[model samples]
Target chain A: MIISAALLGVIAVILAWPFPLVLARSDWPARSPDVALVLWQTIALSGGMSMIGSLLLYGLVPFGNALPQSVIFLGDSLRSGTLPADTRFTHVLALGAAILLSTHLLLNLFATFVRAERQRRRHYTLIALLSDPLNGQPGMRVIDHPAPVAYCLPGAGHSATVLSKGLLRLLDADQVRAVIAHERAHLVQQHHLVLLAFKSWHSALPWFPIANRAENAVALLVEMIADDRARRDVDDRTLATAIALVGLGQQPEVLAAASDGESDEPWISSPERALVAPRVYRLMNQALPLSRLATMAVFVTAIALALAPAIVLLRA
Target chain B: MLRMANLGVLERLLMDVLWDSPTPLSANDLKDSLMRPGLATKPTKPLATTTVLTVLSRLETKGFVTRDRSVRPHTYTAVMTRATHTAELMHEVLGQVPDRQAALVRFIGGVTPQEADTLRQLLGVATTDNL
Candidate 1:
């Protein structure tokens, strides 16, 4: 039990720090955001697993030889209102931390979900009241605004692609089609759910470097993935032009904040400002995608990483 | 699905009529104007008074409409002009809302001028008529 606990501790440390730092610095994610997204999910799953698993195992060592026996014995100890003589203060401390960290993560996830659902409902009410269906466009609604907005309010069966009147006036018909395709990709793929997961992690662990880095990286990757989907329908130039125009009228307030290189403003805003550049560049000068063998290797690694903690814990 | 969709259309149409008027409109008055001559020519059937009332009540509960209980049959009015309401809503919906905790997935980012310049150079500076 102690051996596996120490092993999981090492795994947790590597995943939490050096591994994510190296991954974030790599440019390979730009080549294949889909595979990168899978890798990210595996890392998050395994990291959280090993973190809590190690602590729990270390704390439960005095109870039994394996996880099942330890868990059963711990319940028995609670009923009898006593601990084993081998249990020390360190074991109790580790157990408390493990329980608190798990609860914090889970409660944050639920809170994020509830808050997002409430906000989505409020947004939908306004949209329904203020927006009109675009002429001859089935799933698209046009709002009466001049800031060239485009987005999707994803829902179970009533997802909508909302465009601003300003967007239509700014771009030609081809550009408009490309913009719609991009938003549709977001809705159809449900990118917001992916974001919600990372958002919860970032919110729960605001001080953790990996949490912040993962959220930002995943945000950019999802945008790139959507851009790729839009590219399939329109030529690269058309998609690039559409992106440049739509981003043109976003937030005039951020214009000054973005130009300044050093600011303590939220990290999200700055990276988001620069997000357009890489996406447009990728569209214009398309990089060769990762080859088949490379993609297979990444998938295998992700699968193994995802299953690792389970294999460790389930062993007799 | 169909019922909810119909209610959405009706809500938008009713809000449009109320926003156009200078004074509060009664439920019957709203139904009449909605079925007014120009729109009556369309193939879609006119909404009933009960359906329009139900929608107005829903909008009221959502805080988009104000009910004038002082009048008989209780006239309704849009909470604000469409322009003002749209501007405020757009600011938040686009994540320029103060406090910046947006859950929506915005399609594009705010681009820097330098980045814009780079994209122009790469895309041949095809500034359309709008710019």
Candidate 2:
């Protein structure tokens, strides 16, 4: 049982730091964002599970070797409001940390969801009064503004893709369609739900640098996924052109980048520019589809990672 | 979908009429203006007074319009000019997400003029290749 606890702790640490760090630094994610996104999700899930499981394993070591038996025994002991004789202070401390971490993560998820829904409702209220529907387009609203603006407001039953008149003026008919296709891809794929998990994870562990890195990596991958989806309908060139035009063209006011001679990429200061460079790069140059073997390898590894914590505790 | 989007168009149209008016107008005045066809993506059917009232109430609640209850027939006036509302929306040209972004709002990256030139060159190159 102690060996099992030690093994779980090792898995947790690897998944939490070195694994995600290596993955983020690698260029493989840019090749097939769908596979990369799945791997990221599994890593996040298994990492949290193993971290809590390791502590719980230590806390229940005295109860039994098998997880089911140990969990039942722990439950019975809790119901009776007494600790067993073999229980050590280390076990109590570990148990407390595990419970606290789990509670923090769950509460943050709830908080993010509630907060997101409220904001969406308010945005909907404003859009309802301020926007006018496009005559031919369903599920899209056209706002009368001189600056090009476009985004999708994703909700459960209701979703809207908003475009400003300025954007319409700048884009030709095909480019306009391309832009709409891209926004529609985001809504249809339910990319917002994928983002919610990473968001809550980041909020729960704000102090952890790995948490921030993982969130950003996953965020970029989500965009790539939508881009790929959009490409299915519009040619790569058309979509790339649209992205470049919207991203790089004339703007009303832009925040001046605080230039320090040390940095190379000025776009890093602006979130919009950060998104544009890589997307344009990927789109302009063709992205070869990831090989089947590599894709399979990722899937296999992800599944194994997800099951590792449970298999180690239950059978070790 | 934009099931509520059509409603939005009606709201804006109603507000536009209010903004253009020299003074506060009753529901009938706005209704008569809207009842005419070709009001930019609005319905052509004759609007019910209750429907007009419902939209007015919504606009009033949203602070885009204010209604006076002193008269037999209540009158409503625009709270602010269209330019002011447009100006407010302009600040959010790239679409603003709330802090700790819950929704996945794709942003327009602010491209430096140099990079924009480089991208345009790249796009130009791609076009030549396609030709």
Candidate 3:
């Protein structure tokens, strides 16, 4: 029990701090966002598992040799008037906190899912009313808006890529095609689900730095991944140009803060702007893919991180 | 599935029928109108009244049509002129630009200084003609 408790502390500290910092600073992810996304998922899942496992362990410290025994000990203690002799006030607090925290995270995750789904359904209904099949484009919907917008409402068979009439008028043929390709990539790859998971985690633990950073990083990374896919058929310059045009019309206030790179302003402005710079730079410079070995190494590390807590718990 | 497009086939047919009528329509009236030759885009087979009822309810939900249950036979009427609905749909989508957090993400790409100037030039009042 002592050994497990010590190991949980070490794991918790790493997940809460250094791991997120190191991952944030790592530039290799830009080279392969897809592989990096996998790593991110592993980290998020394992990190969550470890968080819950650590709390469970802490709650069980005075009770028994392992989780099941500790749970039985807790039940017995509950029936009797007194807890185990070694069970201090802190243990009771830890036990209560562990239950509360686990429940909170689970409930938040469920709520986020329901919220996102409701929003998506509403969007779908509105699009059905407002959009028309693009003249010759089968899967596309032409909205009559004039803000140069383009996006895909992600779903299984129901997914539809939408473009504003203003967007059609603003860009040349190739640029328009690039916008289509980009949105198509989002639908084809189902990036929404990836984003949804990260979003739910962020909602669940908004105060946690690791969750906050993970959500931001994953959001940007998914865009890059979609950009990479669109780049397959479209030239980088056209796509970048399309991006610029569309991005310019977004929140002017947010963009103003973003353009002033030296501003000591709070990061309350949309992180999307910071993300845009690297994406444009990547498109312009054309970053090459990392070697196969390095990619494999990242994936291996991710798997190991995910499995580490489980192995520890089993051993205990 | 409920279709929502530029006056979806059913919506357009229903709208046209509603507009031409002097009073509100029952689902049977809509079905009869829809089944008339040369009235609908696809009038090949007559539609089920239930299908017509479902479409009317969807139209009501979308704020395109209104239901009146005060009478024995529940009747429906167009909530707005077709032009008005079209204009409103455009306006709603335009309103979505500032709130991209909901429906669309990544509609914008990185903008260079030159592109920003061009976009600024195009930022005049976006009328139907612009679309």
Candidate 4:
């Protein structure tokens, strides 16, 4: 029915809005040649899979039965001489569908907004506690908390960086600064917003393949971006050494700590941290060269791909 | 330095509401004002007073606003003026750019000719007055 289609269209549009914004704003490292190829292929595969699934489910299913039922309902209404057969039933169905989809989208948006608000509150509280102008650095506050934990809360202007007392005592000043710079970079580049938006997308549509892949890719890319920024402020050797030292310390509860042992799953651990430990272990760490041309090419390609669908839709 | 990255769109809108107001307003006042605008026709779910209070408290903790508890109902004021906050944001963003002039040029390139002329005229006055 027109109503149902309209409802679904609105929901889809609402869910898709965040994706474009995130792609535009993300400051992730340029996709390597291999990564770019993989991402493109993955997107194509997922889009194809979804297209096939939708066709099978919507096209091949009990679509004919529904048509008769709709016709019967229309006849019954027409027989009563109360409403037009054609428009009445169709409008009802459409309105019903629109209401259902709108409710679903609204609920999801509310939940995301609430979660984001809570995170903001926590971030602000941490900022208030760790704010020390005397330190004279644009980074997170390393508080003297009993437990070892690492997390970031985003802010508007100068976002607060927070670390526990355990972390401060565990690492030297340079090591601490390295960690701060890394976290600061995350804030500076607005990476958490990407994570938050992706999380909302996944929650809204758990079956979407692209959502999961995008989430994983974004997590890894953000860490790499932060590492790149941190390296600019600190020597590569110093950063590598700091990452190794932090990894070795191995706090049980801290999820953000850059250590394989800290996480139960080796695959999910921070890739930047993993790269650092091996190089620092052998004392052969060097600055990772960034290819500006490659970065620009990937950025342009992503923009083009993201726009292509919209352009087609608009033209249609 | 608080990063705006963490704040939700609603929170940002709420802050803007407060920032735009000429006088300190209570939570009820803000909720009422925001609702009065009728921006969206979708049935308005009235936000709870507690939610507004929580947002204000959070903003206070973030140093974006200050709360005056001396009155019967607490009133909040923005800690930094709009101009100062905007300037600080501009400074931070410009500092982050790899080439500040290039970034500025790109940004200015996007401005309308009339706007660019106005900016040029303003800059000329400031330059002459050394303000």
Give me the candidate number with maximum DockQ. 1
Q: Which stretches of candidate 2 lie over 4 Å from their true place?
A: A250-273, B1-13, B36-51, B68-74, B86-101, B107-121, B124-131
Candidate 3 CA-lDDT value: 0.71
lDDT comparing candidate 1 with the true structure: 0.81
For model 2, name the residue pairs that clash: A272-B109, A273-B109
For B24-49, candidate 3 gives per-residue lDDT tens digits of: 99999889877777752664567788
- Runs in model 3 deviating more than 4 A are A79-82, A135-138, A251-273, B1-40, B46-51, B61-64, B68-105, B109-131
**Where is model 3 chain A poorest over a 10-residue stretch in terms of lDDT?**
A262-271
Comparing to the true complex, what docking class would candidate 3 get?
Answer: incorrect
Of all native A–B interface contacts, model 1 reproduces a fraction of: 0.59
- A142-189 per-residue lDDT for model 1 (tens digits): 997666878888877667888988789878898888888888999889
Question: What tens-digit string does per-residue lDDT give for candidate 4 at B63-117?
Answer: 7788888986888877766444533322222222222211111000112233333
After best superposition, candidate 2 residue A296: deviation in angstroms?
A: 1.1
How far off is residue B41 in model 4, in Å? 51
Candidate 2: C-alpha RMSD after superposition: 5.4
Per-prediction interface RMSD? 4.4, 5.2, 7.7, 20.9
Model 2, span A164-283: residue lDDT tens? 887888787887887777778889888888788898899899998888888888878887887888888888888888887776554323221211222222222235334566777888
User: DockQ score for model 4, please?
Assistant: 0.02
Q: Which candidate is the best by lDDT?
A: 1
lDDT of 1 at A149: 78
